[model samples]
Target: MPKFLIQATYTAEGTQGLLEEGASGRRAAVEQVVSGLGGTVEAMYFAFGEYDIVLIVDLPDASAMAAAGLAVKASGALHTRATPLLTLDEADEAARRQVRFRAPGAQGPAGA
Candidate 1:
């Protein structure tokens, strides 16, 4: 399973609905949607700024994540950005991999 951080800003129509439904209702709805997709919402919060909602979710796979994103977006209630989270071990492994490259003043992948 992989985790993602979702930052969402509500549309004007969504905000109006939020004001009427309240925060708890929103949270419960999110939880239901995530759980229904074989995912879990680790945490969710409301924020004031560029984003109105922040959610940490763990999903089965990339396809599941994509489905969730599409469903949310199609609702027209929110605009969301989903960032995949990397674990410390994953970061270390990435750093250990060899990458072929050319730098300034270098000929090519291999010196010409």
Candidate 2:
């Protein structure tokens, strides 16, 4: 499984609905949706400013993540951005891989 960070901002209509339903109500719905997709919500938080809510989630794979994200965006009440999270070991593994490339205007090998 892979983890994801979801940043969400509510629309005017979404804010109104949130007010009516309350935070707990929305949280329950969020949990249900995530769990239904074979995923788990590790943490959820509310904030002010650029984003209204943040969620840390672990899902089976990228396809499952895309399904969950697309479903939320389809609702039209809120907008979401999903970022894939990598563990430190994963980052190190990526860094260990190597390849070569030439910068723009740099010459290739001397052979004609």
Candidate 3:
């Protein structure tokens, strides 16, 4: 399964609803949505910042994550950004890949 880190910010109306209903209800609702797509919520939390809520979820794949993002955005309650979470091994693998690039006056392969 692919993991995702979701940062969400609610609209003014959305916050009003949250104040009335509560975070647990919203968390349950998100869990239901994720479970329906063969995924599970790893962790969820409300924060005080530019983003109101943050969630870590494990889904079957990127497509499932996109579908969930579309659904949530369409609801018009919360705006969200989903970032794919990579494990340490995955990061190492990515680093090992032969990537070509140039920087400043150094016009050559990245490793050069």
* Winning model by lDDT: 3
Instruction: Give candidate 3's whole-model lDDT.
Output: 0.93
Candidate 2: segments with Cα more than 4 A from true spot? 102-112
What's the TM-score of each model vs. the native? 0.89, 0.89, 0.90
- How does candidate 2 fare on TM-score? 0.89
**In model 1, which regions exceed 4 Å deviation?**
102-106, 110-112
* Model 3: per-residue Cα lDDT over 16-96, one tens digit each: 989998988898899999999999999999999889999999999999999999998998889999999999999999989
Alpha carbon deviation, residue 109, candidate 3 (Å) = 3.1
lDDT: worst 10-residue window of model 2:
103-112
Q: Please give the TM-score that candidate 3 achieves against the real structure.
A: 0.90
Clashing pairs in 1: none
RMSD per model, one decimal: 2.7, 3.5, 1.7
- In order, the Cα lDDT scores of the candidates are 0.91, 0.90, 0.93
> Which stretches in model 3 have alpha-carbon errors above 4 Å?
102-106
Clashes of 3: 0
- Candidate 2 residue lDDT tens string, 34-97: 8898989999999989999999999999998899888888988899999999999999997787
RMSD of 1: 2.7
